[model samples]
Target chain A: MERIPILRMGDVLLVSIQVDMHDRLAQTLQEELAERVVKDRARGVLIDISVLEIVDSFIGRLLGRIASISRILDAETVIVGMQPAVSITLVELGISLDGVRTALNVERGMELLASSISLRTQE
Target chain B: MGLESNSKLVEVLGEKGRVSLNDWKEAQWAAIKIRREPITEEELYREASDFMSLFQQAVKEAFLSDIRDPVWLKMREMLSALSISRARRGFTPTEMATFVLSFKQPLFEALKQAHGTDSGALLSDVWMTTVLLDKLGLYCVEEYQKTREAIISRQQKDLLELSTPVVQLWPGVLTLPLIGTLDSERTQLVMERLLQKIVDTGSQIAIIDITGVPTVDTLVAQHLMKTIAAAHLMGAECFLSGISPQIAQTVVHLGVKFGDIVTKATLADAFGLALKRIGLVVIKKSGE
Candidate 1:
């Protein structure tokens, strides 16, 4: 739950989550996430929401809005390291995180991030 | 504005000295004013004032509420709706007007046919057929208006039914961000439409951002799987966004799992991921 806003390694921006995601937090995430991702100037985004145990309506819509902005910026965002318990709770609660992308462990997420950085370099 | 007096109805009736001048004159004038090519609100208001001058304030209020002048839009809307239905029924306007013109034979036959049954009681209450039919037609028009409104609302609801009443929003992307309970029907619908959208748009990616989703059951997980699978077949990739902790708990508790699908914490991250997969960058080179 360390509220690390930005974790930059070369070109990729890894955003670390530190609290349960309610609406206001979700809005902040979009703004902060957008700011960081834009700074990469369209490289990639890696968001780590492992510490967030719950997400409510505000956070969910804000996430969608943020994704829309990312598309406009021509960048990529990869969510990594979702807790199994959190995933199940969100599903039961009728949450739609899975509709965003495939859930990867932190290790896999970092690997994907590293690979994307390399891929961008190659491009 | 001047005729908005209570004594206007008595005065006009007194001037004309006619008991049956209800459909007299200016009602038609006001209706015509409403239908002009470039409708003038000022003219309409003037016609309405004249029309109201022929009625008592109470009657004027009732008539205004009933007829809703300037009636151009309302009348046009009702007639157009009737025309659509009439097309289905193979009924033509020419036939109706012709029947009205030669109303004698039909009326006599209708009365004779109805005389033996409940027509006795109905006849006791009835007076003039012309007035009765006009009132009945008014009722029919009102009913049609209600139905049309309902259908339009249903269409909108059908489009963005699940998450939060999704509107077409933009030209390309049709988005529904779900927040509360994913029952079986909603899941099925979301899956079905998302698949159809892939076919419709030829979009390579469909993002399902679910940061607000509180829980996921086995069926909901299955619903997601089917949708993603369909999207892939249609040459589109689906993005699962907003993986909250509560959802994780439900997925695990239900013991349902998906294999090797793309996911992100936020939609922005998901979009970023999609971009990266396609090898697209947002960087610039030279100084401006």
Candidate 2:
């Protein structure tokens, strides 16, 4: 029953995966992320996975699914801090992770989320 | 089982080592008759002389069954060095192996003169020499192949790095001019380099100019799409340029949908558009 910690930064929910995630732990994170997106009334979600080096297709799909679910709850997800090798591996794996936003780091992720939220509000 | 044959080999070599060495040099000189530029006859004689002395010492102490033994280590080392040198000098594998195999004829001639009285001992010694020389000759071929493959793979890696270069045409604009076919492996390199460059420069626009890419088949298109998609996820806007009329027709006929990926016929046109996106305009000087 291990849970990945989700921190609340104002209107954004921050999830940082610091360990080598097993399949069950990743599944739990997906479900918990969706629930927290609803409970915290978050406008944006930023996931920091710079620590994740080995990203298989399953984990890639889970990220895409999280983005889809967050959009359903009116929240945007920005996956951040992907290592260079991981990006190459994911592209080779043919998992494009469509509809999931990304940034180089968490700071840029926050900027992107802020701009996206402002754009939505203005629209 | 090979101990008796080993001692007989040592005895034959010890008695006629000098005469055999001279005959071995003559055989080598004749074997390399086709080549004139890289290695001179004098250098060949020197190499053969050194190798003969080493071979005599090895016959005294080395095991014929296993070339990896410590006593045979120097002989193996010498052969590998010779093979690599010849490979670099553009000698074919057949020629390199001939250089090693030629030693067998002279050694066999000298062995017959020494063990002529005893047919059984002579046969055993001749058979042992054949096995030993065969191993050494095959080692030369293996080393030559390994050197050639190592050289080819290194050059290929260099070509891959040189072909895919991402240059910054403007402050916020980058251009990756691809000049060759886009396979999956090169596409992966392009993606990694483009993404890293995007992050480094904080550039928002990337122009992929594939003017030199000769074809736009489905696989190439798929690779391009993957690169573009990865760049998009990195928060950069990617566009395609250098699309000739032929490539355009092929892409259209193939029914490939490049949704919203601004395409241009030339890099100049793409640069103009990129500048416009970044709010920059080019103006000529007054009297140029």
Candidate 2 residue lDDT tens string, B50-104: 7777788887775556677788889899999988998999999888888777877
Q: Output the lDDT of residue B112, model 1.
A: 43
Listed in order, the DockQ scores are 0.02, 0.34
Index of the highest-DockQ prediction: 2
State which docking tier applies to candidate 2: acceptable
Residue pairs in clash, model 2: none
**Model 1: DockQ score:** 0.02
How far in Å is the alpha carbon of A71 misplaced in model 1? 39
Which candidate ranks first by TM-score, i.e. highest?
A: 2
